[model samples]
Target: MTTTNAAEATTATAAARATGASAATDVLIVGAGPTGLTLACTLARAGAAVRIIDKSREFHRASRGKGLNQRSREFFHDLGVEAEAAASGIEHITLRKYRDGVAIADTVTFADRTPTPGMPYASGLIMPQWRTEEILRDKLAEYGVAPEPGCELAGFTQSADGVVATLADGRRIEAAYLVGCDGGHSPVRKALGVGFEGSTDAEECMVVGDVRVDGLDPAYWHQWFDEDAAVLLCPFRGSAHWQLQGIPERDADGRPAAPTLESFQRLVDRCSRDAGIRLSDPTWFSIYRINVRMADRFRVGRVFLAGDAAHVHSIAGGLGMNTGIQDAFNLGWKLAHVVLGRAAPGLLDTYEEERLPVAAWTLNLTDERLRAVVEGVKEAGVGTEAVITDDVTTLGVGYGWSSLAWGGAKAGGRAPDAPCRNGRLFDVFAGPHFTLLGFGRGSAAALAEAGEKCAGLLRTHLIEDGDDPGGHARRAYGVEGDGLVLVRPDNHIALSAGADRGAEVVDRLLRLGR
Candidate 1:
């Protein structure tokens, strides 16, 4: 809701004045959206110098990306913003469906879900994208980093040493690596000559925005559907506005009419057929045409693409922003490690390898869900229920096929959470460091050795049967007797092995540049 002030901008500018226009930073992030901000926070927390910039003159307030899935919550948990996010978001709001002013079915959003020891956060939360970015920006500020506004990336050239990016204002910035989180039409991806391959649905379009709504119950996501037009109004938490999505009238050229507050009210009136329910004070709006696409490659030498720069998909699954955030999460630790000299440069390769498949599958899944939703709308009046699948939650996204996944059956997958004597496994893995969990007393020596070897880079915790009363840790990890699970900084399982193989895993980490 707030942009970086003069002092923060001056601070960022002063920090960048050292190398070229800015060589003091290790990474230069282009774009201040959820993806770029998440990456900036991740890198900054790891003490990797970063300078984030956005071409926009000021932060745009919008209800663009309103859903943060469970996996993304975990990412925020690592970034130290989950508490604020939880306080600012709402969950388990019911969907009240209607047809031509007649009330229809009432469906709970995330019904039949409960948090377990293995996965504490069971459902996603609904918060506007701007609020999410604000939380990230606030966190980034704690590290003395702020996103420079109205800064555009004109072009860039990379070499073996680093990347030199020329801004639109003719200022050059030198960084060890550059990332593009600029969105679907990213100039960074264009500069890299990467191909964005996908199709756009011209026929399917909706007007989406934030609006102050009255005479509607805020407890439910109100939806109204008829034969042609449809409208959905979901209340945003900690605010008086609601996220409005409705079918607008098309012009002779077949384009949806301009997204004005008046136009939105007309659409709502036409669909809901209720004059008492009103819309006003539209803060931000967009004519969302369903776009499904992904970049051919995620990285080119020292330059990389993330978020919408790397992929875009239908809003069916509400995975668009979450995917980008996860892309940044997947790339964040690897970039930090490489930039901070904690890992080999080769570690960055797994970013694309692990996320490319996820994007491809996400595209297919969202497309299918979109089609199903369309069909559901044609049959009944509700369709969003079609998008609420386990895959949409993104908890199942993993990289088991990645080379970094070494020994355990669940290697390269998301490390599960469990209760421990001190707190929880997640409590130990909260910060910007790798986590090595030693289950059983036999692994204590290996824990000590890893502690000394890895030092600040790795956090080791011993989990014995008595330490976890419910045995959730043992079951979640499939640890039989005495074993070790090495979790990457991104919370992905790097490897898992028996107690005797702990030294082997440690040796592998050393070979992989630690």
Candidate 2:
């Protein structure tokens, strides 16, 4: 991290030497975590010039955020990394509870469900955050763009036309837009003077880290809980390591103890006296205090915020990282469209309009879940399973009320996957283009005309009602009769209408984008 005074001096010097050359890229993204990396890959795949930077000297290797929900699985599939991510992950394991070294009960965190044609990934997968980041980084590398490590965003100024950003080492970067995917303490958000309003619970804190432990079964997530303390050890996929989480003892001054090997051992000893678990090879550690916060606004002029920069919440439901990934997915195509002049600049406003409410809702949901866990532990001697429900999977999130949503059936919802003639509905919606789906034979002409009108911007598919006996796509999309559905680049339903109004709906959506 650079000193504030040094950063200010560098920014001043860089601004004083501004030149008339065109910006180096269309978008400059700070923080190379999942959010920034996903956005970079999305934009670069769409032929937008993007540069991603991070202040960290090296890539993180910890199991920071381990739970990938169903919605995130669909996102990875669209990004073409689903196979790799699933290969590197394990299904959510059964959680085994122990009290005083005596096995009490076992339960699955996420309920099992059969995969439907309309929902390919019906369950969540557990992969370390490091693995997810590696996959996204590899995807970005395919576009010849890698995050510049150790490059700090010292300061930046956004004008009506572009943004001038100064790095800690005095390198000046010019971009048409800047995005702060940096974590909770985002430099870009600070520079933009965005208000982050929330409360941090100093009384609630936990120690989290990765370590190699012996004498513990790797099949199930082992958890030991008592009245005042708790310890959980879950095997991290793709490695001989376990992610350890526990309530740390407080110091003499009543502050939460610092996360160290000794503190972790003490926690284990207190929670599991006779489990015989021997912890060693400490890889990473952090004392995490619960913070619930959201940025007052996600955009400021030509600069914007995503991921933890825009909102942060309790990790009770594993919403932090997944929400950030969704934020990047939502922003990527919009940014690309505006940069390529395929859409009006106002299209960027929809990023915040669609995402901010989702963030707010997630914050409240996690807070409620956190309260449930705390209360359940206090009253019932264990956390309730209610914390991990279908809502945690994030499959129900959508933009139903946004201005971009139109039509009568399933409009403004996530476009579900279903078996198509060639592959699946997702396969048709893949890539950086919109999709127009005609649900029955009567809508063929409308689909063809819309495809011709939107040429490179859209791809059209016609699935007759008799094509599949199950009628999965029609049922999933709520198409009662011959209807047309337009899916946005982010795989959300933009418009759905009867066969007669299909072309009109397409024209109105294109005009809005224009």
Candidate 3:
């Protein structure tokens, strides 16, 4: 309060600047999985001084989650790594679900649509977590930020202005915001002492392995369900290995004891019935129990939580990692603005309000899926409801409770997909940034104005391909003739109205982004 105290504070600030670049980071993210890495890239691209740390020494070898949804695929496209991933090991397709001895649920196929809006990508693909991480790491590296592995968070104090985290080695970082992408057993979550409310399925155990299977259909992910056992098989195109998920028991000592081919054989025989083929030595294997749960809240003052730190759920929809990715998408831009003084702290509240219910619904739906599979209820057809809810793949997700008010044409529910010309070829969603789609003459001129006004913050696309306007696209965006739609950084519709309200659209999008 006195001159002496002010001078002391100034000196401390100056000294901090001298050591480690002395920056109170705009965002400090913990964990380096797909979610954290994606957040790092997105935040760094937004020009925020971001720091990311993880407790793991290296990327893990085990295969955890595998399904990459259509929405996520589109997101990867925006990041410019989808093609690389497609070349690596990921197959662009969905799965077929079966039960007992019959194919009850045939997989629904999704085709590639235009770059207009809805999800801005095609149908989902099946890929391993390891490869997914590899793509994300490459993207982050492109942005000149790498994950600080082997660095763990010990504790933190959240003041009104910032979060201070003490590292495992006794270093502290004062960050404007801290988002925990750490897994289920997050040290940050424990520090907050918030309860993770849900039940663990202890009665039924699960066995998973990546094995080399010869002469099996590599095109589709196969599932078999019997009264006694269930088996899930997915092909790994890179190594010619099949990632297997089954029900297996553990030893009395609580050790894995589940690496043998015998356990896998039983599941195969019970479900497949046709024992013409055999499953031999595995490349990887493990056994464990799973739970369906979520955290009560996703925030605590300056310390916020995302990904597994915020919620954990059954992988029925392969949503664990995907949900975490969505958390990062929602939180990244808001953090950028808050640190840059463009938005108030209240903007962060929407993270929990938007994602918590989604997590809860996901957990509940996944549990229902497991129960249906175990109880032989899929035969009745009511069980498939649990399979995919809200397309939590991030496509069906929307910013329903947005804080911005661009009345004439603000963001609505889900964005739609439409075709656009990229000069080279047809383009899909104008993603990785806010995209504006316009119709009618002079639409492109208006979009050009909006683009220049917020060039770095938003991307504008003028679709002049057809005369009738995009059918499904028009309905999804609620635009009729001459109109404009504003998509957010994450590809959700921020504002969807006619191009006549172009000025209002630009104002709302820029302010909301701030």
After superposition, the stretches of candidate 1 with alpha carbons farther than 4 Å from their true spots are 1-22
TM per prediction: 0.94, 0.94, 0.81
Compose the digit string of candidate 1's lDDT tens values, residues 1-514. 1111111011222334444364557889999999999999888888788999999999988889998999999888878899999998887768888887777888887788888898888889999988999999999999999999999888887666567788889998877778999999998888778899989988888888899999898888988878888889999887998999988778899777888998888888787775588888878888888888899999887788999999999888889999999999889888887666567777877888889999999999999998888889898666578788898988988899998888678998899888898788887898778888999999999999988887767888998878978999999888988889999888889888888876776677776633
Each prediction's whole-model lDDT (CA): 0.84, 0.84, 0.67
Q: Whole-model lDDT, candidate 3? A: 0.67
Ranking by lDDT: 1, 2, 3
What's model 2's lDDT at 410?
Answer: 71
**Model 3 segments beyond 4 Å from truth?**
1-24, 89-122, 250-262, 265-283, 377-394, 405-410, 423-433, 441-456, 461-476, 498-503, 506-514
The TM-score between candidate 2 and the true structure equals 0.94
lDDT by residue (97-159, candidate 2, tens digit) is 877667788878655776889788866787899999999999999999999999998888766
Clashes of each: 1, 0, 15
Query: Which tens-of-lDDT digit does each residue in 277-351 have in candidate 3?
Result: 478767677765687667887877666778888787776667788888777877787666555444445666667
Every model: Cα RMSD to truth: 5.3, 4.4, 5.7
